[model samples]
Target: QLMSVVAVGDQLVQQQHFGAERIQERLQDTLGNWNHLLDLAALRRKRLEEAVDFHQFFADADDVDIWMLDTLRLVSSEDVGRDEANVQSLLKKHKDATEELKNYASTIEALHTQAGQLGEQDRTAPEVVERLNSIDHRYQELLELAKLRKQRLLDALSLYKLFSEADGVEQWIGEKDRMLQTMVPAKDIEDVEIMKHRYDGFDKEMNANASRVAVVNQLARQLLHVEHPNCEQIVARQNQLNHEWAELREKAEGKREELNSAHGVQSFHIECRETISWIEDKKRILQSTDSLEMDLTGIMTLQRRLSGMERDLAAIQAKLDSLEAEADAIEAEHPEEAAVIRERITQITQIWEQLTQMLKERDSKLEEAGDLHRFLRDLDHFQAWLTKTQTDVASEDIPGSLADAERLLNQHQAIREEIDNYTDDYTKMMEYGENITAEPSTQQDPQYMFLRERLKALRDGWQELHQMWENRQQLLSQSLNLQMYNRDTRQAEVLLSQQEHVLSKDDAVMNLEQAENLIKRHEAFLTTMEANDDKINSVVQFAGRLCDEGHFAADKVSKKAENIADRRNANRERALQQMEKLKDQLLLHQFLQDCEELGEWVQEKKFIAQDETYRSAKTVHSKWTRHQAFEAEIASNKDRLVRVQQAGEELMKEKPELAELIAPKIKELQQQFQ
Candidate 1:
């Protein structure tokens, strides 16, 4: 019935298209119904993003909770491990969380991007176009939030590295100074002589540098308030220098104290950290001796275990051999089924080889894929950076696109307004046979007055909806059945509107497909990578076994060789001590019968001149040794300092921006010296 009415109206629309009011009504109804469907589809797509965002929120919250719990556990521990003040772990945890959030934010950002793409499909639908604007606005706000969050994390991390390093340096310096004060007086005569060579300026310089670092760190933090990247980069560079300087100073101070104490020391100078470190290693080796023996026993157990696997493989091979022989004997006995048996055997063997090769390739590919994972991840991010920084993708330019959209939107606005102006309520009521009219008229009977006045106003245009409904009854009939063409028509309109909204997304989708496909492959590739890792681990273990075999022989030789070298190095100091002892006994032997020879011996001693000026030769000799030792130590410190400087230079090279920021300060310091 509705179709017959629409067919009558369709004949009129065929003559007038939308130029006539009746035809225009049908157009509006169809377009409105179409827009509604498009809106629903867009809504469905948007809900997916909301779902993803909800998932991300819960996951991120869980991660934050886990991190807080882990940190709390360590903080609450009554018996803290050596790494109680593990700044690295703290930094790493913070870094990981920051990065994870960035990843999630980026994904949300990508969805925002996808929504933008979806928006492009709704250009013809005014309602969808409006909704697109709303989404873009929301995303722009979210984008700003994400960027600020990342920047804040970076600022916190920079400050943390500086202060954390300062704390470590301070602790180290305190312990070093304590060690210097608590160390016992020089024992051996030769040790006292050696001490003189190595004890100047190390502590003094460290104390000064520690002070410098503290001041510099405070200055940097104060200066780090600027929001600009240049200012931030400058402060971070300065803070880094403070950290490096603090490390160098404390290490240098400790090394100096060590040098001073090492003079005329025992067989191994505990001052040479490597010496004590080696001793500790030896002790640890002794401690783990039982474990090593157990490991040897386990190796035998492993060999015994290998026998079982070998037997299993051998049994499998034997079954295959027996099956082949049985097939041959069957063929000889009954030739009729010989061909079928041969065919089956061939098929089985072929399938086995194919399975083995596939397994091998799967393992190999997985490893290869794993090795590329980091590179792929970096590459992926680099691509993301490109997308983020794309010249065409402008948040600012969206307004312009929207302006174009709004212009078209307003044209529809004009059309709606024009229709609204003419369709007065009273004019439509008379056409619909209601007891109302456009004009206030005097008639004794209310019904006649209402009907006559409304009829007189029937020539009024499409301002009123009732007039639209009454005059265009055929249009209304057609509209009531709009559900028939609802989905297909609206979806197409919505899709068209979105593309025109943001032109860049249409441009970006050309690239997004490739990336999406690659991401899809990532999960499968990760599994393969794990399998490959096992193979690589096996190779590593085999290499370690080979090294262990060589180390067994090398260990025996090292034990013998290192001892001989130790004895040889100790020879010079032992001789110096002996001479001091001999000289000390000189006074006791003075009344010997061979007085002249004794006098000559005394004369030839380094401490005494031939002129016999009552020389305390031993004292003088010890003083000279002290002077020489002090000079050597200073030289060693200078050499060590050069090493630290070189390392710092190399570090600065990698972070060249740091050099650009710091070189001015260094130059100013140099000029002050000059």
Candidate 2:
């Protein structure tokens, strides 16, 4: 039991030692873990210090450093796991260090934020002091600005109060000077100087206001003393002036309208002169009344002048009406002459309107005199133009050729346009003549008589030329037709000659049908030639001769064909008789020669009888003579012997007894032939 106890004690000691080693190992691991945590914290703090410029926040950086040292000491110490109290204390210290580090980091972040806000990498005391000094200086300046603003407000209020009343300007000036003197020492020199300038401006403004007030007072007094005109009296005077001016203006307007309506310059100028005189008289009277100084005598005098002008205007108008009526009578008597005279008068009137100012510059009274001179000049010019126009019309020639006609037509169109252009001018002149006070000279007034004569001549001449051209064209057409007819007739003649030559062949009978067709074609050409005989008589005659020749040739060829046919018939008849006789003789000779069967010799006899050489032998004697002459020819022929032998062989093959009976006879004949 003691040994066992001793063994247990040893086991307890070993177990205790093992537990101590394990505890040491565990403590070492905890220390390592803590060191690792410290390392992380150190790295974080270092990065924070570098990135955030932690030295700028010295307090926060120092606190973080102390926390780091405490953390390091706690982690490095060996008493961490000595007891529970020690362990608790170590944990508490670590926790406190962690908290301290967190707090330091927060403080550093806040300082960094502040540095960022200040736009500074290092928030040093010098920079802070400099900023504070700048703020202080700005505050001083603001305070000075506030004081100056307050003083300016006071001055403005004082000036406003002073200027409010008219009687306070002088007292305000005195007060402003005293206040400036008082402010010289207490205020900034600049503020004092500004106040002085404001004071001077206020003084000047007050002076100007005083002057304005004095002027206003003076104007007010003057207004009080001035009296307005009586409304009724002034209105009455204006109405009277208006009535008088209206009377004069109405007269002048009537005269102007009348003068404008007058076609003649003489009447127009006279009316214008009276109207202008009346207007001048009215203007003089109006000037007298413009100053409100018109009297009854002046008005009566104006009325008298106006009355005289009216009387004169009425007399002139009456004379103008009478002259116009007489001119109308004259125009009715000779309308064309009156028209020409009026045209001249209108031209003169136009010249008067254009040169009125120029003439007036030469002579004030030239309004009438110039119109007279212009009328005379235009009259002479118109007469000369009339003479020239008559001559031009008489000289106008008719167009000769087509091109000349076209040109003359264009010229005629141009002249018509010119006449149209003259219409307005001529009408205006006629109207002027109707309004003229005098009669115009009428030496020669041909009007458009010469133009009409020339137009008629041109028309007649053009008609004649057109007829000539038409005749020439017709002649040319006839000549062309004649030429075409001649060409066709010659072509028909050539065709007829060819047809005749074709008919002349020995086969005229065969070609007779074709020749008849050609005859029909030739007859058609002859018909065409006859139809156009008037155009091509020579060609038609030549074509007629060719047609006659073709007909005669065709008749001759037809008769020859008929005679040849008759001769052929006769010859055929005689050949048939001779053939018959030759056949009979052949049969008789064969019978006489004791050959009843002549076989192929009968066909040979028939063929020889129809031969051309014996064709003309119509008599039996002649045929016999021919046969006798051919007998010698038959005897010398080897072909005849071979033919006879072949015939005898065929006869033997066909009829052996008959052949045997004829063989002797054939042998005899063969012997005779040999």
Candidate 3:
């Protein structure tokens, strides 16, 4: 049991030595990690100090060093726990310090960039100077506390150099100093001049330095108080001068506008005056006597003048309108003058209208008067033509003269109607107030009354002459009929005398019939002549003589017709016996006449058959045959005896011998046959 105890003790001693070796190795490894942590912290602290030195905002560099030292102390402590918890605590402290150093470094970098820009700024301005002073104080503080001496010193010296080179501040300070130095008392005018010059110079310098305005203004007040003895009076005088100058400028501008308006008004007024002159001239022309005597040429001239006047009036009106517009532009200033001009224009327009009306009335009156005058002349010519036509109609035939006179009367009537119409027109003109000075007199005019009376006389005379001509024509026609009746009576008497010796019953009967026709014609002529005797006095005696002659001829023809009737009754019974006796005597005469030819053919009494006897038939076959042939040959001798007896009666009137012999034989044969 004691040997086993001794072996346990030896085991315990070996285990203790092995445990000591492991603890020493673990401590050595932890010490090495702590040393590395210290080195990293130290490097971070050094960089943080350098950042703090470069810019004032990095002043947190000391806090990083304190935190690193505390962490190292914890790591090197003998009694402290060097376990995982302690190591983690130490690592956490180092990380916190490192993060703080990074934050500081970032802040310092931004501040350094700001300081660099500030160095280039105009430090003469108050806000910039103030900011520079504050930056300088912070830089000095940072320089004293920073561990990186070289960078801190460099940053502090740069801020100092920027402060020193700020020329804008020196300029501002110099201006203020000059303003104060130039201040002087105004004991005399010369002193005032000298101080005024000094203030002018200070104002000129401060005008360029906008940042030094407050100090410059303060100094300017001090100088003004010293330079002027009565500062308030001088300021008041200056203000009054400025006020007067403004008033003068406004008045001058108003005067310029007024002058322009006045020129326009004057120009328009002149134009109006000229237009009025033209109107007056036209009015005078319209009132003239020549205007009343309106010929074509004169009327045309007046029309041309009126046209020109109208154009002038239009021009004047246009000018007036332009003037009115111009007046409206300045009416606020010149209302009374514009109103007066407008009134004048209105008056001129009224006068022009009156003149135009007068001219038109004058033209109408003149034209009416001219028409009346022409009508009067035409009436005179018509009267003369009518008188000449009346003279021509008196000497002409009824048919021709009446036709021409009626036509002339119609023409005269037409002209008279036209004259009446013209006179009515003239009366109308008078009623309408047309002053027709040259109008011909109408109602009391001698020529018109004379023409009317003459026309009535001519119509009456034409009717009387027409009646006379009709009476004369009837007398002439009756006279011609009387002459024809006398000629026919003489012709009937000659026809009755020619039939006085006609013993033939047929010839005497024809004579009686013709006498009856003559008697009938004579009765008709007597009736016509008796009917027209009163109307035709010149033919009454000649018509009575013709009637007597016609009655005697008709009575003679009737007596001869009665003789022919008694002779016809006696001849009827003896006609056949007379015809036989005439034939026997004609045979005896023919036989005795052909005795030589018969003696040659038949020496004493025998039939001689010779060529001459046969050709002439002068020989008889027997005494009895010869006698019968002789009787036949003389049978037509009765017609010859009748013709001879009638011819013999005509010969008896002429006392011819053949009539005496033939009449005796015809009378003896007629007595024997009866």
How close is every model to the real structure, measured as TM-score?
0.19, 0.16, 0.19
**Which candidate wins on lDDT?**
3
The sequence of per-residue lDDT tens digits that candidate 2 reaches over residues 1-674 is 54464455556566786566655565557667778999999988866765555344444444544544554554444342333344445456555544544454454455446555432444555754454344334434433443443343333333222233323433444554454344332123344445445555644654565553454334333433442123343334334433543443354344333332332433333444454454345345434432321222233233334434445446544644554564565466446447654554354344334333332332332233444344433443444555454444343354444455555455544544554565565555544533442234321323233323433454354344435444443433333333443455555445444433533343221233444454455456445434543433344444344445453233433343344334434433543454343333333333333343343464475587678978777799988887887776665554655665665566567545455455676676565444
- In the predicted model 3, the residue pairs found to clash are 124-169
Q: Candidate 3: where is the Cα deviation over 4 Å?
A: 1-246, 262-271, 289-292, 307-310, 323-332, 336-339, 362-674
lDDT of 1: 0.44
Q: Which of 1 and 3 is the better model by lDDT?
A: 3
Q: Model 3 TM-score?
A: 0.19
- What stretches of model 1 exceed 4 Å from their correct place? 1-127, 183-191, 194-674
Model 3 C-alpha lDDT versus the unseen true structure: 0.46
Give the worst 10-residue stretch by lDDT in candidate 1: 391-400
* Candidate-wise lDDT, in order: 0.44, 0.45, 0.46
| Clashes within 3 Å, all models in order | 28, 4, 1
Q: How much is 440 displaced in model 2, in angstroms?
A: 14
Cα misplacement distance, residue 545 of candidate 2 (Å) = 42
> Per-residue lDDT tens digits of candidate 3, residues 1-674?
53454455456556786566665565557667778999999989976755554344224333334543553443333332234354445445544544554355455445445445432222244554454455445443443333233233333333233223233445454555544544533334454555555555655654554443333334334534655343454344334433443443354344334444554556556666776786777678666635333543344345445544566657655755664565455455568676776676677678778776876775565456575444333434444544554454343332223344445445444544544555544345333322222246533545445444544554455354445444443433333343343444344334333333221333121233444444454345445434533323222344454345553344443454344444433433344443343333343343233332332323322233233553465454665585576456446544554554455465456545345444555575444323
Residues 384-502, candidate 1: write the lDDT tens digits.
Answer: 43334232222222112334444434443454454456345333433443332233443444645543553444333212433433333333222222322233233433433332242
